[model samples]
Target: MKDRVLDLVFLVGVLFKGLDGLAELVTGVLLLFVTPAKLHQAAGAATAGERAEDPHDLIANLIVHGVAHLQHGSIVFAALYLLVHGVVKLAIVIALLIGSRGIYPWAMGALGAFLIFQVYELVTNPSIAVAILTVFDAIIIWLTWREWRRGRELRTTWRGTVAWVFRRRVAT
Candidate 1:
C-alpha cells in the first residue's frame, strides 16, 4: 500500500513535470513567432473587463509587463532558455519513469540545485507557480532517495541470504 501510494505520487509528479515542459516548449516556440505587441494585444483581449484580482487578470498583466521589458537579445535568450529547460525536464521525467537506478541521484542533485534557485526567485518575485514547483521538487527528491535506499537494502539482503544458504550447504 505504501509502495502503491509512492508510485502514484511519482506518476503525478511526472505528469506535472511533463506539463511544465510542454508549457515551456510551446511558449518558447510561440515567442519565436509572435511579436511583443501582438502578445500584449492578445493579453489585453484575454483579460478584457476581468477583475483586477482575478488570476487571469494577474497572468495577463504579468504577460504585458514581461513583454514591456523585452529586448531583442533578451527575447532570444528567453527562447533558448525555455527550450533547454523544457528538454532537460522532459528527459528527467523519462529517466524517472524508466526506473534508472543511477539517474535518481543525479536527478536529486539537479532538482536540489533548482530548488535553491526557485527559493531565491520566489523570494524576489513571489510566484505561486514557482513555490508549487519547489515543493514538488522537494517531494520528488525525497521519494527518489527513499527508492534508491530501498533498492540498496534489497540487494544487500539478497546477497546476504545467498551467502548464508551457501555456507549452510557447505557445512552439511
Candidate 2:
C-alpha cells in the first residue's frame, strides 16, 4: 500500500514536470518570433510617440514595450508555475514522510537552487531572469526523461492498469 502511494505521487510529479517542460518549450519558441518591441507594447509601455525626441529613442521605446509585455506574461506564467510546483513539492514531501524516501536531499537541493535563482533575479537585472528560466527548462527536461524511462521500465515489468489502458487505445 505504501509503495502504491509512492508510485502515485511519483506519477503526479512526472506529469507536472512534463507539463512544465512543454510550457518552457512553447515559451522559448514564442520568444524566438515575438520581438521585444511587441512585448513592450503588450505590457502597456509608452508608445513610440512618447519618447520620439531622444536619439536612441527608438531602442528605448522598444525596450520599454518589450519589458512591459514580458513582465505581464511573466506574472501569469509564474503564478501557474508556482501552483504546479507547490503541488509537486507537496507530493514529494508526503512521499518522504511515508518513508518511500531517498529523494529528500534532491528535492531540497532543487528547491534551494530555484529559490536562489529567483532571489538573484530580483536583486539584479531582470533580463537575467530569462537565463534562470532556461536553467529550469533544462531541469524539467531531465526530469521528464527520467520519468519516461521509469514508466517504460514499469510497462515492460508489470501489467498495470495504466499500461492496460494505453494498450487498449493503441489497439483501436
Best by TM-score: 1
Q: Each model's TM-score, in the order given?
A: 0.71, 0.35
Candidate 2 Cα lDDT to native: 0.53
- Candidate 1 local lDDT, 69-123, one digit each (tens): 7776777777887887777777776776665667768777877887898899999
Tens-place lDDT digits, model 2, residues 42-147: 5444445556567366666666655755654674565456555555555544544454434544654565666666667766756565666646545543543454
C-alpha displacement of 166 in model 2, angstroms?
16
Q: What ranges in model 2 sit over 4 Å off?
A: 45-66, 69-172
Clash pairs, model 1 backbone: none
Q: Candidate 2, clashing residue pairs?
A: 40-65, 40-66, 43-68, 43-69
- Per-candidate Cα lDDT values, in order, are 0.72, 0.53
